[model samples]
Target: MTAHSDSPPSSSSRRRTAKKKRSSTPSTKEGMPSRSPRALSTSLESIQINPRTPKTPRSNDRRWPREDDVDEVELSLLGEDERRQAADGMGLEEEMDYVSQPPKKSVSSKDKSAIVLLVILYLIQGFPLGLALGSVPFLLREHLSYSQLAIFSLASYPYSLKLLWSPIVDSYFFRSIGRRKSWILPMQLVIGTVMLLISFRAEEYMNHPAEHIYEISLAFTGLVTFSATQDIAVDGWALTLLSEENLSYASTCQTIGLNTGFFASFTVFLAFNSESFAHKWGIPRLTLGTYLQFCSLFSFGVTIWLLFKKEDKETSEEDINIKTVYKTMWNICKLKHVQILCLMHLLAKIAWAANDAATQLKMVEKGLGREDLAIAVLIDFPFQILGGYVAGRWSRGDKPLRPWMIAFGPRLVLALVATLTVFWFPKPPITIAFFAFLVIQTVLSSFAGTIQFGGIASFHTRISDPVVGGTYMTLLATFTNLGGTWPRFFVLKGVDAFSIATCNIKAAGQQLSVKAAECVSEHGKQACKDLGGECITERDGYYIVSAICMGVGTLLVVFYLIPTARKLQALPASKWRVYT
Candidate 1:
């Protein structure tokens, strides 16, 4: 928006305006509660600050310039649209998109090319992540116990641990190659090489998992490490790649790309690789090696694309200091509110830990096919997307945590539904009704899960101070991931610890109680059957643990969590910063 005035400013008024501009603190550095009272009116009159972080100017995001932005020579370079806006406008806020900026393409054109590049980069990061997190677990569940799967889960920790090394990546780069691309080039290549190297022994690793679990875990950990490093570079690139008008698409593209990659690796791979699916459709099987090789080659393709299409901005040695980044993070963490939030993030996932980690495995043990599980997830994928979209919408505006609160109960309800579904697993030729039942539960589960995650993330985005936002967010995310992941191991172990099993001998017409471990493994259960008895769970530990979790979770959310979240969200933005 351009402003209009009838006459030029007098010398006295010019001096006064200059004095005011100099004395007033820039609002973007820290949101001061003391506004000039005209600040709101000034913002509305001109300068379209990015919607991603509202009017706040992030260290990375684009912001508009003020009174003294560009000299006359630089000013001459501005396009038709830019000159008109600058001529009539007076500088108000301290933000970034100064005069003499390059002409923006029409909004109709948007930034599709940049966004697509971002998607490809993120998709490259996600392919192996899904293989390790989703496909591997399903495959391993058939052979390994939940306790063992918990150990395998450690492969994902490299991602959770990446925050430790983020400052190094963010601070230092080979400027000639490009800030992000320097890391992206080698990281993607390494990721691809790791996947290819592991591909040759995929069958061997799976065939004798117990003997080679560490090798498999260590290999996948390396893959995740490179992916995490690539993630850092890509995220840094995104800050510059996105235009002001399409800034919001950064998160949207990430969600779409990551989930798309996951769907390909986990759902599509499982379906095509299924023996039943291949036999039913007369199609060739998709082996783990083939899938890994495909992912590897795809990563290579993206690496080649990056070489040609690297971002225009080169890295600056100006702001590259690892010590400052760490210090900034330490200051953010020292705040009382951050400490409390850290605690909340660490404790929040306890309720869903068992449900998330073990429920599907329980269903599989009761005879559900991995292919069927994949199909259910495939059908629910759209619903999950819809849920995240709707939740993202609902999470906007002042009260972002409301949808999170609403989503909480449904997750608990879905957990119960899953428990019942497993408890009532039907015999042989698993009917359509059974499949439908699982599908419904999974759909609701996906929707609730996505909604809850979106809501919390929105809250995170809302509260983050733009100055230290990247570091603050990374720290919070680490704790959040830690919360979810740390509990999964114990929950998996608990399921076995609390179980009671009995052997039913039909010939003797007697049921004899047996140790939980005796009836837990595939071989153990088979051994019980071979001894003229069928292994039956007298009391399943998963159900007991889930019930306890739900009950305890409900109380925590009601008495402590809901109130804490509401108060935190309502707190003044200044309160979240290190200094007033």
Candidate 2:
């Protein structure tokens, strides 16, 4: 729990405490006394601004202010050296309360080993999530004849509805094993088991198209449901596993692990020829069952490996009640800033979704294949890592605002890169030019995206009320899904208008040709030849959709980013939050 005082402690009192603690410790080479963990913890706890409970008392101490009942900005009023000492003392074991100061929780090696095991177990579970979801579109397109829009619509359901059950995971625990681990381990087992079962179904259902679709949908839905549940558990565990000091770094490591799993399963392996595999296996027709079976086999292998891994053994009873869970969710809603930040996060993702949708279409229209898209994503990942690293480097100081500025200000660069690419892609001097443009755009997007997420990480952590961190993040996820989906919904609906307009224009041209032939017999051959192929009207509409969507999306980002940039720029360098 964070320590809060009604009034500021006197400088004399602070100096005396410092001197006494300093005298007890060994002197450094420079003759300055080292800081004690207790003092550092005290100072940090003093300024914690609990975002969820704003009515909680504020403090004047200089450590990195947590969002717990205390405010972080107030803590930045301290001298740089003091803040640095506090920050250094905070290692991976510290509590991350949005509304209170984080307490560094020290555990034995046994417990640490448990956390390590848990990480591995959860990572294994995350793999099939990526693979299954990523593969859905391809499977539907090839076997079910589902349109791109329909695939997008269908696969999006699980992620979009994650929040509905987030509370149950947060507050409710099993009576037997433990709240988090009990649920997590079993769920992992279920996923693996289901996946394995799904694999067998693939061979049996291939010939019957209707049966194939039904079985595939069921298996896919099961995977999504459990995958989402696993995500909840993992996120909660991540919050509880580390201490205040190491939370940032640990989270980064977690992200790396999660993304590695996600990319390998979803982005990389998804390109495999599952359709052909069915044929090779002598299946009469492609079945959804086969696809599930493949994914299940892979998932089961990982699940078996994870069952023996080290994981958290501790569980608490206080964490399992529905009433307690609702309280936590309600508490998260009480934090106004968290709500705003969630909205901002949603908006940012919306921009990204729009960009991604447009980019995929444009790439195909330009005659690029899936290989090119893969290369583009591969190139973008590094830039994102670089951006995250850069932001971490620049975030050391008393300035609380510097990181925000850096985070939100550069998004326009992404918009610019995306918009400009459309023009260059078509008229590029060579394919190399097209490749270069995409690579550059990918890098910029990655950089901006990294910074944006980094900012979110810091904000969420800083404002975190440890008890409710799970709920707060889940709510944030809910909003993010909403933001991402709304734009796509509208865009998909409007696409038909563009299609209809193009068809009408082309029909008009054909009518003109008929009229011309009737008026002049000599020109009939020329008119017929002109109308024989190459529908110019259709081409124009295609270009218009590409151009208009990009133009509009980019313009929207520009407006949104300007104020965000200005605010971020105004933040002081010293107070900028740093996460590794």
Write model 2 residue lDDT over 336-373, tens digit each, in one string: 44455555655664434545444454443444444455
Tell me the lDDT of candidate 2: 0.45
lDDT of 1 by residue, 1-580 (tens): 0001111222222333333323332122232222121110000000000112211222233222223333533555777676556654645222124433457456444378888888888788768877877788777766666677778888877776677777777655554565577789999999999999989998888766767777888888888788878877776666557654455565665666666777788888988878888998999988999999999999998888778885664322123256766776788898888898888877776777778878888877888887898889889877765775677788878998898888878887887777777777787569998789789988888788777766776777667654455566567667756776677778888887888777766666666665546576675677788888888877788988888777787787888778888888888767777533
Could you tell me how far off, in angstroms, the CA of residue 264 lies in candidate 2 after the best superposition? 1.6
The TM-score that candidate 1 achieves is 0.79
**Whole-model Cα lDDT of every candidate shown, in order:** 0.67, 0.45
- The segments of candidate 1 whose C-alpha lies over 4 angstroms from its true place after superposition are 1-111, 315-320, 501-518, 526-536
Query: Which number leads on lDDT?
Result: 1
- RMSD (CA, angstroms), candidate 1: 11.2
How many residue pairs clash in all the candidates, one count each?
2, 47
Q: Candidate 2, which segments miss by more than 4 Å at Cα?
A: 1-116, 132-135, 138-151, 193-221, 238-253, 270-295, 302-320, 334-341, 349-352, 395-433, 465-470, 500-580
- Clashing residue pairs found in predicted model 1: 63-96, 63-97
